[model samples]
Target chain A: MAKTIKVRARAKDGVVTVKMLISHPMESGRRKNKKTGKLIPAHFIQEVVTEHNGNKVLVANWSGAISKNPYLSFKFKGGAAGDSLKISWVDNQGKSDSTTAKIK
Target chain B: MNTKRRLFLKGSMAAGAAGVAMSAGLLTPGMVLAAWNEGAFKAKSVDEALSALMGSSSTEAGKIKIKAPDIAENGAVVPVTVSTDMGGVDTIAILASNNPTPLTSSYELGEGALPYVSTRIKMGKTGKVIAVVKSGGKLYSASKEVKVTIGGCGG
Candidate 1:
């Protein structure tokens, strides 16, 4: 199934601090099968982008060591109440999901 | 008749001794309690963990603010922060949606302290990160997805 993400942002004093969490299995290929003793294929998200008021503010790149359902937090400049922040992510399998939050 | 009475007395003594042993720490309360706790903590899934921690089957959204990267370069140390503007927030918890044990950590906020926390966690791969907050005797949650480039769990 495609990953799901949620974003929450608050704007204050010309800066917006955003918080987000995403759902995914994040299976590392290193895990061995108990039945057949074979390695699992590596699957993970690779990149994330956050934009405030349609302007890019923060970006993050991830490796497999990250636990499943990764959590991220950052701040951006110049967003106000009623402004929208957009967040998008791309996984290793080329799957992507994006969501937006209105500043409150 | 004397032998019969003596044998009856010995049998009664053995029964009394056995009863005393039963009450005198022969059956440890600690072991039973430990086993119960292990079962309690054995959540095979994220939803199960949440239910166990919050004592509720469902959690509402919008009372908590969970922050994490949309993409992490290193899964070993992805930073996470949780904050709440809602008044009377008592606790905040972080859960990895795809982790074997999804409930990563929980923090209890005191009355005087601010209702916010930040920490780093390990990620197995790309997945959703959830934050649940308890306030006014209710549970609320939020989630975001993060992408991992390199395997943090030695993949």
Candidate 2:
């Protein structure tokens, strides 16, 4: 599966700033399909994890209440240019995907 | 608040309860995903939701900062950012008080992760956007009100 997360990491003054935008339906399960008249199955990102140089830096927990295509940003101490940062997420339905970015 | 927005918020809360029920039996066997905190998302009241998620009541801390718009043009997408200098922060959770499911999202920070988070959440109407930070085995919180105008029909 193609993960919908776009990640950017930049090292500035010894700290790394990481930002990402995830693409997904984030269906709340309450919204019904207009044609079939059936509740759309809930399929939202339940967890997100970010790793830097093999060290876990950030993790997020989410629910269907979040808006479609969630946006996440954060900063952390101690990262250098050319370092690698990986971001990944697992949806409620057990689907998962990941991507990596090189710090600028 | 607009009557339609109020009605939608109510509907969300009811659906939130149903969302909890769905998770109970929805997960397939041998699933790789971790279990969710159904109690917090399903709780009707903000206090209840917070305690359920954090496992205890939180104190208002001065080190926390929350940034959000005083007036939102759209309830469907409102940007929120939370940052804190508290040490050993474990998780950052955001809640929209007037939404059917008051708890919106949470972030877990490890030793290397910064004590900051930013995200966009959907709100049902006018409400306070709250940020709760857990550090040193305690929870702290900050909040600000946001008025959401839908298609210029709101006050």
Across A1-104, the per-residue lDDT of candidate 1 in tens digits comes to 45488777887877666678888666555677677888877666655667765555654444343557777665545677898877787665566788888988
Measure candidate 1: CA RMSD.
Answer: 17.7
Clashing pairs in 2: none
* Fnat for every candidate: 0.11, 0.72
lDDT of 2 by residue, B1-155 (tens): 59999999999999999999878656641263435677887787788888888988656665788899999988767889999878888889999888777888888787677788989888778889889898888888889999988611111
Q: Which candidate wins on TM-score? A: 2
For model 1, residues B20-105, the per-residue Cα lDDT tens digits are 98776544534433322222134657678767766774888865677788898987677888777887776666777766656656
Candidate 2 residue lDDT tens string, A15-78: 8889899998887666777788877788888888898878888878887777789899999887
Q: Which candidate gets the maximum DockQ versus the true structure?
A: 2
TM for every model, in the order presented, reads: 0.47, 0.82
Tell me the lDDT of model 1 at B27: 47
Candidate No. with top lDDT: 2
